[model samples]
Target: MSTNTLAPVLTPERLATAYSYSSYRQLIDELQAQGKTTGLQQSAALTHYTHLNVQRMQRLDKTTQVVPELREAVQNLQQSYMWLVLTEGWCGDAAQIVPVLEAIAQASNGRFTTRYFLRDENLDLMDRYLTNGSRSIPKLVVLRVDTLQEVAQWGPRPAEAQALFLSLKSSGATHEEYAEKVHAWYARNKTQATQQELLTLVRDLA
Candidate 1:
């Protein structure tokens, strides 16, 4: 299992201290208010992602549907686990993916819980699970709640979506082109791809 030696492993106590989804929502609200009064001092990427995250999160919260298999798998979980996600408000991928994770946890009926940590602030942990040495956002670190041993890790994007992204990157696509394509893929898939993958991961690990 992937482990972060430089940083302390997250315990339930530690995870509890991180932002919950509701707290994350409040944070975005505050940021939006700040942006309206004075120009957001953050990078353009960060500002744009913050706005996009609000919209994406709201849409997911309203529309995300957990598949029966996923629900059943989670419902049958014999062990307690925590999904410690490393992400940031400015990560577009995180905006699209995190809500689905939240939905899954809720469906598990307390068998699972999720917490968020900013990737930039948790560089030690992020570095331990780098996707090919890059600090990918929205890295899901699944751990057994009892022992805190790492179980499985998933991140950044689904397989098909990541493939599309790599294809565009290899072709030297512009950032706008790449992002548009990725966002379009997410829109078309509507979290189905992500749900299925997580189902498999959770089942195998469980």
Candidate 2:
């Protein structure tokens, strides 16, 4: 996890620079306006393929045992690796956090790029990311560009700990419930450790 500010105060100009940000927001807004509050299915359509990167990362771990090819690739372009998100227009998670990740990646000197994968049709690709016998969307997959392998990932959890936190605040959940869940989750996942690790990973790549 990296320690530098990973989320920034996004301005209009910065938002525009991220081509997918506005479009993604529109998709979520449209659905919400239509009374489609739980956009889980829609999110699945947009973000399922992110799991492929995870599979790729798993393979890298194994391959590096006998071959330096995988490790070499990560080491080579570690600095230019992209926070390649397999996202979609309708996903709440993608809409909210993708921008922040992009901002963080960009602040790191073009080290990250957002890439989309339509989960609706890319079922085969989506299979790579399946966990707990289910498919999920807005799966954030970080990649090492040189090796095209995944470095880290987090998602499919309840919206409380993610960018979806914005919406959960207004949803039916009480403040105490929300705070309790977030605190529990943060403790279970060791978020602070992950952030430190992320920072170290990026710096090492640099």
Question: How much does candidate 1 score in TM-score?
Answer: 0.90
Compose the digit string of candidate 1's lDDT tens values, residues 48-153. Answer: 7688778998999999999999999999988888888887777788889999999999999898888787776667778978887898878998877777777788
TM-scores of all candidate predictions against the true structure = 0.90, 0.45
User: What RMSD, rounded to one decimal, does every model reach?
Assistant: 3.1, 14.6
Give the Å shift of residue 144 in candidate 2: 4.6
Candidate 1 ranges with C-alpha deviation above 4 Å: 1-8, 11-13, 36-41
lDDT: worst 10-residue window of model 1: 36-45
lDDT of 2 by residue, 31-121 (tens): 5455442224644433332333223223332332212332333344536654544555444334333444444444444556665454554
lDDT of 1 at 107: 97
Clashes of each: 0, 9
Judged by whole-model lDDT over C-alpha atoms, candidate 2 comes out at: 0.46
Question: Which lDDT value does model 1 have at 145?
Answer: 75
